[model samples]
Target: MLSFNILYSQERNVYDENIFVNCQNEKLNWKKLELNSTEYKYTLISKNYFASDKDVNYYNGLIILPIDKNEENKNVIEELLKLISIEEDLFEITAIKKCEIQKLYYSSFLTEEQKIEVKNNVIGKLRLGIKN
Candidate 1:
């Protein structure tokens, strides 16, 4: 398995970098953005997009990270939704408050071309949102 670290600034800005190599052969560069006074954003910029010939899938999983579940980070979710624009019928957001380390795992079976498309789309949206 691969490992990564998401570093957060005192002001709440978040950035991530890979810590180890794994079989997935994925490279990610994360950027930090402030959504507002109290919210921050973390976005992934991959070295290569997922293949296009495969179908992308989303699964329900638990997030293992450091997050406060007391509604204090509500703006984070709102900012994420604004950035990614999830489909109403296919995506849903829920919060669980039992752990200090939040973990989430989702499987995306996208072809290389499709992965690239998704990366471009997501980065484009994030760029637009941050510029505004």
Candidate 2:
């Protein structure tokens, strides 16, 4: 997921965590939940404290990728950029991309421990920025 900040009326991607992918003029950030030799799983939140809004619920999702892969890998982030598109200045998955990713069962990608951490910690803080 990607967060956005409007600075001097120019939109930019702002993230609390370090960027995991930056390619083709697009940037993305994620939190690592699990890592191993073959692959790792992470969650990317489209919403941040400064960006809390109705879209939060829509754009949150998980991603799993091979550990051997890096930004230098051919079309690594590019393929991801295709899966998670930025719309209206915010990173969001279109219905088509969402369906494609959904088929991969990203939720099942996380282990039980990661699930608890995400629900208890991540979800609790998901919309903390929104005005009451």
Candidate 3:
């Protein structure tokens, strides 16, 4: 089972409790979930499972591929940039980038179930953001 803990710049947090991926004999899972958005901004979380605490583990970095949703075919990266530009602050770009990067350790030391729950919630929030 894989799980995650996600954090947003708006002081919002989410979790993904259990993500199951079956392997040949045993299940392959992750301890933490990390995501890097297409624009090199916006980080998300993920996790993995293991047979025992002593088992060796590997880090799996999942990239969030750009999603095209505009008639001009604007992807997530472009949209994010546009959104950041709307802010009148002189350092809006740096601020947004920092926010995204800061999410890396939003919720560490979470249980497997808690991580999964957070991930699902974050995905829902992302969907809602897209809709709006």
Candidate 4:
């Protein structure tokens, strides 16, 4: 069971990191902000992007939920999304796009070899979930 858990975690990490790399390629300027919460120590992967009008600055990204021993991924993500939606409504946010990437990278984090490695390792999964 322990080994299976470790394998699952590793796969998830690869998926997450591949998304991060793809975000960098798109010039989204992603950032990981620390949420001020007492219940969970989760990091928010946010990105600053311009709207179609180029007047309003929109923020969107994923909530990096911690691995809980008791809860499944689907449950945890759903609960977190609900909480975020409530907060967004309170704050009048326009939309919520769920995804994760750390730091606003104006430059590439992956080397030439590393890029090839990621492409080979998870070619099918290398996509940023953002639509615009």
- The prediction achieving the highest lDDT against the true structure is 4
lDDT of 1 by residue, 1-132 (tens): 222221111112221222111213543333334445644334443222222322332211111112343366545554554343332121332222221222221125333543453342211111110100
Q: Model 1 residue 71 lDDT?
A: 63
Q: List clashing residue pairs in candidate 2.
A: none
Ranking by TM-score: 4, 1, 2, 3
Better of 2 and 4 by lDDT: 4
Candidate 3: list runs displaced more than 4 Å. 1-74, 84-91, 94-108, 111-114, 120-132
lDDT of each: 0.28, 0.29, 0.28, 0.33
TM-score of 1: 0.29
TM-score against truth, every candidate: 0.29, 0.25, 0.19, 0.32
Instruction: Estimate candidate 1's RMSD in Å.
Output: 14.2
Model 4 pairs in collision? 62-99
| Model 4's TM-score against the true structure | 0.32
| Model 3, position 111: C-alpha lDDT score | 48
CA deviation > 4 Å runs, candidate 4 = 1-38, 54-56, 68-71, 88-132
